[model samples]
Target: MTTYYRDGDVVITSTGIRMHGREYALAELRQVWHRSGRRSWGTIAGRGVLGLAMLLPILVGALGVGIALVAHASVAVTAGLVGGGILVGLAAAPLADVLLERVDRSYDRGSRRREIWGRTRHGDVLLLSTADAARFGRIYRALQRALEPSRVTR
Candidate 1:
């Protein structure tokens, strides 16, 4: 039988399975799932910087437009300025997209790690060998119980 235990409580029961104390069910888990793994914070930060780099051109173009307006440029020059601004903004779109894609790819890798951990049936199990195996066993058992179909206790 599968069972789940959380925070010293048994929150659910099905057949011979039981789930305890989880405020949220696995079915309700929706977010960037993360698992304990070896990771480099610097690499993650680098990806964030790349995303921000994509916005630089847009910011510069906006500043140019503001400067032109303040200077009371002629209509022809003002129109040209606006046109250039639009082009710059358009160009930035693809840059931002590429950077965001990279960031998303990194996140996808991390998410995959989490999925693997969750599937291992080890509760809060870290990837490291030093992690508590007993806790993971309990968690895995609880998860198993929670996932089991409910039984009618006639």
Candidate 2:
């Protein structure tokens, strides 16, 4: 039989597919499909809250400087303080954006998962999953073709 895909311990041949120590014969395989897992909306919202927290210092500093200037602080002294605060805040915003991007990447890297399932002729189910959804989909479609060549449609 021809081997269509192979990565690490997983292998897919024309006769069978194997992953995570589970195996299923092509003839015994009755169905192949994929399903998405639960989403992490709460984690996403938490990250947005943290991003706002990072901007809090800039907001509070600007408000304090405005109040100080109105209370008759020397123009030169107030300007220097305000200017410095603004620079720090301006620098912080981009840094916060970069940090949030890194955080988002890490979160997505961990959460990118999909389940590949196969139902056998005996009605037993075999399952596997990976963070690589495209790879999983490719393997599922290949199995579908190999197991049901006559049943495949254009």
Candidate 3:
């Protein structure tokens, strides 16, 4: 009669847990575990790209200032351009963070996965996974609570 967790695709009640159209009775659930996978190469590459994007502007600006100074531009102009370039580079930090966040979300949306496996008394395995960690945790913990016997008695 108690509802422990309910997400869009996963639900856990006192009687059972239902996920992705598959259901397992609480009394029959013998084991439940969370399985995590390794980070994908695409995620590593995306992080590298984001880091370079954050630093490239600053490096380019410094190179530009050096070139202008060597070309005999006035000290005042060089100084002003360097200051402006530094500001621009600082501005790019937030932009880079935003881009990194977007990339992370996109990868999570398309590729990230967390698996929850439940072994039933009948030797059947019920599996479910999702991209959202909080949601997955809710289902995982709920199932654990349902399977575990309560210590306190009325």
Candidate 4:
């Protein structure tokens, strides 16, 4: 007969490491504490904002052209308005790209920790090297004990 130790709210590994939250597949790990979060949504929102900002210049140009067409204004005036819009859109593209890159880098740096291991909503996993196994074990044990249910009910 095989006896399986079912975890009751808390699960500990054979190495005395306490498992917290949902466990992720090892293959899914990209970097220490840095994982993609709602990337598709962010991409869509970013594009939408940039598109809206770009449309402002086009709209202004269209209004100017409409006025010129209706009032028999000079062709130079209409062309200048449209050209200005194009120039503004062109400048915005690079600015938007730079802003997005900075945001992504900030998020990546914020998620990283200098500690041997860190805990997040995802799960608690050891990030220490072989040389620090003993120290890691001590911390793991401490965390496990803290997570365990209290024996004395209040």
Candidate 5:
């Protein structure tokens, strides 16, 4: 069988598609279409919220130190607060990194996602769903190319 697309166990071939251990025969697909919509944002943004939670106490402490400095507090107390806040902020760096990474991914993944669907003898079926637009485009185009040979008149 000629493989139009192959990625791990998921494949598109002359005969059909095999993904997630499910098989779909190409002959059974009468028509195919694409769908795009928003993805669930809560999970990604939630991490940022949690990060904000973690940093709030640090921020409040810093603000208190600033006020103390402005009010001519003793040098030893100001120095201690500055030193402690630095240590705590440094200690929380990894969690802050995670928060920033999640925020970046949310932007990269964007608001919309893509899906492929096909009409078959039994009914309509979902062929693929992904947040990765590049992969989706590649697979969808491959499916189109694989089906094209059958549609041409000899």
Candidate 6:
């Protein structure tokens, strides 16, 4: 079988999906849909605050140097601050990237919950539920791809 997505206890193939040991046939599902729960404002705001907190030192230092440079108080100070800023920025480049990535992930995962539901001949059923946006999107996309062939024939 062609595997579209596989991770942990979930797997989606050309035929259907097997998640946490339960199986659901693609043909059996009349419709598949996704819902993203309310965004966690507190979590998002906290992450934003944390990200700013992490960068506070850098910004403060830069601001100090910038003020000194604009004042033309001392040519030596300007040169020294500029060089130091470059060095510091370079040294923190990787860390800054990691921090940004973390904040981005926090926002992506800020949703309280995510769900995939399906309508079948029997009735509506809950197919998958998760708080991970990335994982939810991957699974939902895989399911859509698995259903593509069925759509074309009709």
What tens-digit string does per-residue lDDT give for candidate 1 at 16-92? 22223224344432221223445657766777788679888898789777766876889989888887877887889
lDDT order, best first, reads 6, 5, 3, 2, 1, 4
Off by over 4 Å in 3: 69-71, 75-80, 103-112, 150-154
**Candidate lDDT (C-alpha), each:** 0.52, 0.69, 0.70, 0.44, 0.74, 0.79
Q: How much is 35 displaced in model 2, in angstroms?
A: 2.6
lDDT tens readout by residue for model 3, 105-141: 7655544578877666567464786766666666677
State the lDDT of candidate 4 residue by residue for 1-154, as single tens digits.
Answer: 1111224333333223223454432233333331222234554465566667656655665665566556655678767766665665566667656666755544444322234344434665554422223333454444434334322111
**Candidate 2: where is the Cα deviation over 4 Å?**
1-6, 13-15, 57-65, 68-71, 110-113, 130-154
The worst-scoring run of ten residues by lDDT in candidate 4 lies at 1-10
lDDT of 5 by residue, 1-154 (tens): 8989999756999988886687888777788888997766775567568778668756866765666567666888778777776666565667667767776666656556888888878887887888876778788888888778666211
How does candidate 6 fare on TM-score?
0.71
Model 5 CA deviation exceeding 4 Å by range: 2-9, 20-22, 37-41, 44-61, 103-114, 121-123, 129-145, 148-154
lDDT of 4 at 76: 86
The sequence of per-residue lDDT tens digits that candidate 6 reaches over residues 99-147 is: 8888888867655789988887889888898988888888888888888
**Top candidate by TM-score:** 3
Best model per lDDT: 6
Q: Which residue pairs in candidate 5 collide?
A: none
Q: Between candidates 1 and 4, name the one with more favorable TM-score.
A: 1
Clashing residue pairs in candidate 3 (N, C-alpha, C atoms within 3 angstroms): none
